[model samples]
Target: MERVAQTGSTNADLLARLAGGEHVGEGHWLVADRQTAGRGRLGRGWNDGQGNFMGSTVVHLTAGDPSPATLALVAGVALAKAVTAMAPGLDARLKWPNDLLVDGAKCAGILMERTGNAVVIGIGVNLVAAPELPDRPTAALAAKGAVLDRDRFAEALAIAMVDILWTWRQEGVDSIVRAWLPQGHPVGTPLRVSEQGIDGSFDGLAPDGALRLRRADGEVMLIHAGDVELRRPVEGN
Candidate 1:
């Protein structure tokens, strides 16, 4: 665990270190108080709230490891567990891939990058304050009355990751998927796939963790990648 007052982007910094032949061990985390160049999935800017949790961790992959992409699920389950543990009954849930939500509002997100034999997973949480997102509603632990200490949350997250990661590697992706299903948005929830320009209902996740989207035609599509959003009912509908 390492804490820095400021940095451009913890994920970028850690990736650079790894590319420069530095050994970034698993379980080691690089957390920044403020990330000037923080980013979310699809190159979106990640808002840097002062008291939020912004950090990156590396996972070294070896032969026989499950798909690297499934790490997103591992990270999601770990994050959801950590937050729910700290603030019990907070209604924390995970949106597919790796977005954390509380009562249908996003509160945190995860980004993963692969290089050589390692994957760097970056995460940001709205702990004390939530950023104003143009497309989605946001929430914060403190605003919701959780009032967590940033440092304490970081420690809890790290511990949770260790346990979940082990399960992912030892018990297989199926185990992670089972643990994740109950923590995620309930099946049959309406959703829209931004990339595919299609709408569907959440059917659940595939065995390997790909999203299972049940289309209007009653056909189930296995979406390997896409920007998924909860399809909210329009007013006056």
Candidate 2:
């Protein structure tokens, strides 16, 4: 683990280190106290909340490994386990492609970037404070009555990730998918695909770990990529 008081972005830093021929072994993590130029999925700015968990780790791919895309599911399961353990009875849940939600409000997010044979997994958790956003609601562990130190949470997350990665490599994507399903929104939960503006119900994940969305016409669509949001009913609905 490498700690810094602040940086532009942990993901960018790690990728640069790798490109410079530095050996960033698997399981090594680069943690930042604050990231000035952090980014999330869809190129959105990632808010830097003091005392939050902001870090990136790398996974070197090999010929025998499962599809690289499925690592999102692996990360989700690991993160869900770590957060659940720390915040007992917090009602934490996961969204497809690795978003962590507490009581339907997002509390954390994961981003994966590939460079050559290495995949960098960056994660951020709102441990001490949550940022208000225009698109959806957000939550923090402190506000939810699950106060935890950033370093302690990082340690727990690291351990959980190592164990889950083992399961991913030893068992398969099937094992990771099975572990992930029960920790996510229950089947029949309403969801929306942001880009396509198409709404559907959560139909679980496909065999290869893609999201399965059941449409209104009873057609099941496998979503490979998109911004998926839980669709809450309108005020008068």
Candidate 3:
């Protein structure tokens, strides 16, 4: 793997380098020590401290393969497995598409961008605790009593990604779906789906990864894509 290590923001540097024709080949790693311009899902700015982990890897998929959820699934399964191995007692749960959480708080998030058959999978995991984060709830591995050095820990994570991605390529998304279902967001449980125009939609997880919303009129709607933040079912609904 070709590793490009940066002392500051990795993503912004990556975008600049990518824009400048720096060949980001498959299996290349871009790591950051402190991300001044770190980004979370939905273009939100996320900053990481010196000790936390933030990185991106490039993956090449076969041409015309339109598994829209591919990078998210790989990131989800790989991150969950890595955290599980690191702290045996800390059970990891997956939020559909691209989040890994522990005890109802986000521990890691994946942001993917695609260019033809190449995908850039950006990942952020807090190796230590962070404070005053936006969103409903968030967490770091250290906050949950797990700690790891940014580099060695990232190597293990990359290895896990290799195996999972191989399985995904050989088999299908079902490979991950089957593995993730049992580790999935609670089916039939309530969620808050957030989007620009359509927010505040209460929902649950459908079998095919669609968000199922239960509205005020007692109607259930299927949402194909949106930001799903977990929430409790309102009382007396």
What C-alpha lDDT values do all the predictions have? 0.94, 0.93, 0.72
TM-scores of the candidates in the order shown: 0.98, 0.98, 0.83
Q: In candidate 2, what are the lDDT values of residues 44-95, reduced to their tens digit?
A: 8888988999999999999899999999999999899999998888999999
Q: In terms of lDDT, which candidate is stronger, 2 or 3?
A: 2
RMSD of each: 0.8, 0.9, 3.3
Q: Tell me which of candidates 1 and 3 scores higher on TM-score.
A: 1
Where is model 3 more than 4 Å wrong at Cα? 1-8, 64-66, 196-220, 233-237
Ranking by lDDT: 1, 2, 3
Worst 10 residues of 2 by lDDT: 228-237
| Candidate 2: stretches off by over 4 Å | none
Model 2 scores a TM of 0.98
lDDT of 3 by residue, 1-237 (tens): 434445455655555566677777766678877677778878876657778888988777775443756557667888888878778788678887688878888877888876655677888887796645655677878878887877887888888888888777777666766766666666654566666334334344455545567765767887777787776556894
Question: What C-alpha lDDT does candidate 2 achieve relative to the native structure?
Answer: 0.93
Overlapping backbone residue pairs in candidate 3 total 0
| Colliding pairs, model 1 | none
